[model samples]
Target: MTFNHIDFYDIPHVSSALETKTNSRINNCSSSVSKFILLGFSCTRDIQILLISIFSGTYISTLIGNLCIICAVRCDLRLQTPMYILLANFSFLEMCYINATVPNILANLFSEKKTISFSGCFLQFYFFFSMGTTETFFLSVMAFDRYLAICRPLHYATIMTVQRCFRMGACCWVCGFLCFLLPVYLISQLPFCCHNTIDHFLCDPGPLIKLSCSPAPTTEMICALYNSVLIFSTFLFVTSSYTLVIRAVLRVPSAEGRKKAFSTCGSHLAVVSLFYGSIMVVYVSPTAGNPAGMQKIVTLFYSVLTPLVNPLIYSLRNKEMKEVLRKLFRTVR
Candidate 1:
């Protein structure tokens, strides 16, 4: 069920029973596990069928909502600004984020055997986390943009030029993908013996690390360190940016100025709270301690519910976005 804490290299010569156990699971234990069983959700056939319907609808709605934001940004010339550009890309990232795991989840729910190939599991892990990392960086970047627009109004345009905005977004993507390389690689290389069943829906690092044939404190530390650095640094940057924005808004002499200032950022602030508030609970600490049900619920909150509601938050609260969507709908009709 769990690996004993031991040195990494010392794990090669495992006990005979362990070796036999590993061999029973796979023909070539030396080559590592070929597949994994994702114990996603266990329920009666009726519940699973009900879940399939619910998740399918959720997935479809999430895609459409995020896609509309992207389409609105691109089609409406008025929406072409640093903020909207970043938002459009963020929507795309959400699509990818949900896609990384939801399809497999649906598949497993429908099928009798909930098996995922080793490569498939790791790929899901990589893209899912990579998108998450990018989302953090993107959120901070969006906050910085707000800080510039609100606190340094005169310089906002000059500083966040279109070319510069693209570059910043690109940097977030590149850094996100690169940052997880070490942790994923390390976890992948560690031998997975007899137990190949992941308790959670997706191949999360916590369960993966727990499944290793030997305890890897160094790997765990590395993962924890990466999570802490990525989450805290970006979280601090977003908080700091908002702090300055709030201070600037407070200084405005007119009530209208203050109202408009808050209006510009209210949706983003809500989104930030939704994302960071839930993610911190799961990733800030080693996820080994989290109950399986809690992990699934929290992950669903951020990954599925958040994306589904984002378009509503952005479009409904902002009049311009609403108007644009109306016109686009009329044009389509």
Candidate 2:
């Protein structure tokens, strides 16, 4: 895949020749890029099945766990508080986020052909971005919920009413979708005259940005700026919210009150820590050599493992949820 540099601004006749040359190169490249090879988990046959089984279990468990949260929150009238509502929303978003990446991965693992079409790849990237960003927003919202519950106990109900919670959830979904539209569009517009083989398991922005044959400095800069703003702003909000929460918890006169507050927030804090920590390590660090494998492992933690754990954490730790589940089982039996 040779890229011929043509100065369209300077040479008119040469520009025509360059256009023909570029067209020829593009046609060949397009034909060759009919299917993108996904260099997934392992090259060994036995290891591939092991990877498939692991991903399948993760996918099924994630779906079931999130669905349980949603069902429990909706069915149990006693659990209809703003906090549980937000928890249900987070579970739903996590389910969508994991679904966006896991099924394709499972399919690639089992099939002999590990190729994804160009448009298919872009669509995968789009959904992954949409749901991942939504998760980030939901996390921030959850943090704010905790902040209000702890810092402003008297006003918690008024501040996080049903209407307000619904509005916040909707905004999280819409804002995340809108934020990535420009970046996805910009990446789609660039001609892939270079290698089409994406190094990672999915069509992530990092790998796609590196494969652009044209001078993509502006595109890269735009992506980096957007990612940095999203990551850093959300981190700041979460940190500040939790800091206030900690202060309020400490000021509580009773040990039981402090313990309850910490228990309510412990799971969310654990998840946020894991997610942001891995993201900073993968994206914020300088991309000198290929870190695709390492990135995939970190990506799995957030994309697969986090979703799987949300319901488990909430269910196991929450007394209200446990009672609700028990009632549901008895009713079914």
Candidate 3:
């Protein structure tokens, strides 16, 4: 059966059939994609079940804790101040924050087919990052508030009026969301070739960029630059404020006054440390030779555990928040 003795035209039908089969697959790929598969947390079935239980408890506790903060702020007339108002806003953001990804995560835990629609993935991508950015701004806003209250106590009331605080909070949300729009747009317009699998849990930029056919260095650098700048700038602002706050507190000449000042800022500092520590490791640090599972663990820390711990951080040690919570619960009972 040597091909050298055969006429190539005699096998045109075979060639045509093979060509048709290849074309069919190509055509199938040409259709609009409605969904993507998420290969989240490579684990055995039993492990996934255990993870579901763990995440379910975490999600529920996060929800309840943040809700309690919101309720305490809303119910307590004594807490109708700028600080409490900002606290409530932050708690509300935390609720939406965890809500954006936790429920889907829980579903994927049990689902045989773990898939998310194209629109849903991008929406989760945008809102989740936007909320994180907004939180950075809010943290900076809070630091500024602390600065005013501690350094310029006499003018704090006049400078940080109720209306002004609300306006500043609104500005943070607006700017945070708007800051990443261009980068997101650029990423969205990329040609994602045949592969439609997302490697991570929540459509994070790193994993999404990896799935694209073409490398996106410029877009990635821009987004990373934005994240780094936002994180560092706000963090620096917070640090400076606390520096001045500590100096001022030291000058108070009374241990009670110094302790009081530190108490107000302790929770915020703890949260800032947790957030920046985990996020910097994931987004800003060099990853060329990083361990495989580290990113997921760091992301989980900031995204899930941070929210769950925030209310405890704020309320557990704060006499004011504790009083308000007890009163609110008593009133309900």
**Best candidate according to lDDT:** 1
- TM-score of every candidate relative to the true structure: 0.90, 0.91, 0.89
TM-score of 2: 0.91
Weakest ten-residue segment in model 2 by summed lDDT: 282-291
- Predicted structure with the largest TM-score when compared to the true one: 2
Q: Write the per-residue lDDT of candidate 1 for residues 108-154, one digit (tens) a residue.
A: 99888899999989999998899999999999999999999989989
Off by over 4 Å in 1: 1-32, 286-288
Q: Please say which candidate is ahead in TM-score: 1 or 3.
A: 1
**In what order do the candidates fall by TM-score, top score first?**
2, 1, 3
Across 28-79, the per-residue lDDT of candidate 3 in tens digits comes to 6634556778877889989998999999999999999999999998887888
Cα distance off (Å), candidate 2, residue 137: 0.8
- Residue pairs in clash, model 2: none
Tell how far residue 19 is off in model 1, in angstroms: 10
True-vs-predicted CA distance for residue 7, candidate 2, Å: 20
* Candidate 3 lDDT: 0.86
How many steric clashes does model 3 contain? 0
Between prediction 1 and prediction 3, the one with superior lDDT is: 1
